[model samples]
Target: MSQNGPKMNEFEASTATEIRMDASRSTSVFLTIYSDFASAEKVWRRFEEYADCYAFQSFDFLDVWYRNIGHRSGVEMQLVVAWGAAAKPLMILPLGIETSKLGRKLVWLGNEVNDYNAPILAPNFGDCVAEGDFSRLWSDILDTLPAHDYVELMRQPKMVGHQINPFTELGLKLNASGTHMTQMSEDFDTYYDEKRTSKAKRQFRSRRKQLNEIGETKYVHPNKVEDIHASIDNLVALKSEALKAIGAPDFLAQPGYLDFYKELSAQSLNEGIGHVSHLEVGGEYAAGNWGLVFKGRFYYLLASYNGPKFGRYAPGLQALVELMRWASEKKATLFDFTIGDEGYKAEWCEIHEDLYDHIQARSLRGVVAQSLTNGFLLAKRTIKQNPKLWALFTKLRAKLANHRDFG
Candidate 1:
């Protein structure tokens, strides 16, 4: 039984039961599931009080994200909270239930959108776990894993925390590796000077020259509400056109997704937590980008523009450069080009944090399924690591799996 009164079904994990609580520790009882958004909010709000470094798990952030994406994603969430004196929240695991190929499973509380994933813990709580007392608390928490076939933690940023390591240590099969984008410093002049070689710098300057010589134009990041709306429309049109040309779907073009973003922008701006930037030439919206400004960090989330007209000058690149400069001027601590390992990120990235997809299985069938999945992942990794072998193996595999159903 949990030290806390009773387990909340919404946050219960299916794979594990009977958690062991630590009697020696000062931390109080644990709540298996948060009763409502308000409950989760209370815990998250305290997470900031415990640790400044873990500020991403704040109540305001959770509320905004849940408001925008929760309804459509089909993920049900719960908050795990541990309290101390006067119910000081010490640790939290944001969890959600999702239906995967294996069956119902526990997932990272945040979905694909949030860039970072880890348990929100108190400041200097690192030593608490290290002392081995919190291990019991952790085990108690794990015991609360509802009777699910698997647990999947998708897209973790960095491995410095106990969230990934603890699961693996507890006999769960761990698979840690994913793509990462750059977290460049906030000083634009210094960043560009340090990252751009003489040749690359010269290329950018030359492109600017070509753009100026070709047309009489100007670029601006609009602050007016009306101008921002117009810019968003232009960006969406360009993005839709590009996606259609490539035979892929545009995320912004999804019926409700665009409106969701617009709503998020309005809410974030109202709360002083979002920003939008645009590039205008000849008083027309050429390109636009928008993202969140949370806890002194800037996340570069989305961008779009009319294509090829400024190809020689790379207007998208130009927009990013100017926007980043603007961010630096605003004194943001970090600029996160999140969730991809594109070449552009390499140019200016000083920090490349690896993300991972973690999975834990229950039941005999789930075990076999996990084994097969890991085997396939290992093979994929092998091919990725060796290009020559990858070419040969991929061709054979593609030939074998070539069928209408593969798509």
Candidate 2:
């Protein structure tokens, strides 16, 4: 085991510190704390190479997101990295410390925008950690983290790259809803036939026929940089309007949200990971989708369509069909509708990937905070899962919005 200070990295302007601890008589692990982003970039770049990493955990994606969005939003980076004996990097827990009404809390970095969150573990490490070793590791992490009321980790997958997520092994409550996904076939025809029911296929065909009647419709995955930017802009604008119409807060309206996407899009252009697809009617963008392709899976992230103009034709559904065909052609094995259980998602996806939320209280105040937070989440989840309750809630929300808009 080795110990180092911030002086090792010249770019370390913030407090750069490292600690080494023995997990067992024979096994030792070292933890490094990075307060500055630049100091961690080199290590994160190497850690990303392990096949266990997902696109959302990539340095390129999170770096852009953190710089543009998280940094300004009271998020303080506390990236904890662990390395095994011989300095073999094992995992990177990208965390941030923030102060809220409850108190100082530690959370997973990119928790706001990231659909799937888990420690970026090295290959084969998740299954190798013994129960005792994990307990020691968790202790080490808690000791290293700055003073906080609780540790809250959300949207964690049960497995990453076929290995059980170590976080789940610690025991956590299930998140509100499971993410939806579709397993793709080798060919688009086979996938469409297998995933979509006979009635669904008929409806899709009818929708496509209706779309064609509007104009010369085209489904396009834009590779050109300019087109990508334009497509993202269209998606944000359309989505904002849709949210307004539904009386929901427009996420894109939030500070730095649009910039985060634009930055991520630009940075991911050469990597072929960030993809922007669009359905155009009469040469005008009718629907757009921004997604990521990593390790043979396509993550459907954000999507929007000109609902008022194209709702009758179901242009969004048409765009999704074309996108699935594109994914099949690209040899993608799965199409994950990242973190929602909308009825439309169920129509296309049969697989449900459960996510978990973890909350560990450290003190007396933390216990009270945790209980309150947990109760609120449970109530919110109950409402969300009940169709009648959720519909009534939305109706009320819409009426409130109407009052605000008209008054």
| Alpha-carbon lDDT, every model | 0.61, 0.80
How many pairs collide in each candidate, listed in order? 11, 0
Candidate 1 off by > 4 Å: 1-29, 49-58, 131-139, 159-187, 213-219, 224-226, 240-255, 372-407
Q: Which ten residues in a row have the lowest lDDT in candidate 2?
A: 7-16
Q: Model 2, range 162-280, lDDT digits (tens) per residue? A: 77788866768878888999888898897788777898789878887777777888997776777778888899999898888889988788888887777667655577467778999
The positional error of residue 91 in candidate 1, measured at the CA in angstroms, is 1.7
Q: After aligning candidate 2 to the native by TM-score, how far in Å is the CA of 294 from where it should be?
A: 1.5
Model 1 compared with the native: what TM-score? 0.78
Off by over 4 Å in 2: 1-24
Each candidate structure's TM-score, on Cα atoms with residue i matched to residue i, is: 0.78, 0.92
Q: How many backbone clashes does candidate 2 have?
A: 0
Output the worst ten-in-a-row residue range by lDDT, candidate 1.
11-20
lDDT per residue (tens digit) for residues 1-407 in model 1: 53444334333322322233444663345444663476455446646654543324556555656666664677777666654444444567777777767677776654655666667666555444555455566556655655666666655554423333333344333233344334546567887788689998788788767766756556665556676666666776787776555444456665455655555555544665556677766565667887777666678877877677765567788788888887777777677787655567777776766655566666676676667767876776566556587568656655554442255
Model 2 TM-score, all chains together: 0.92
lDDT of 2 at 338: 91
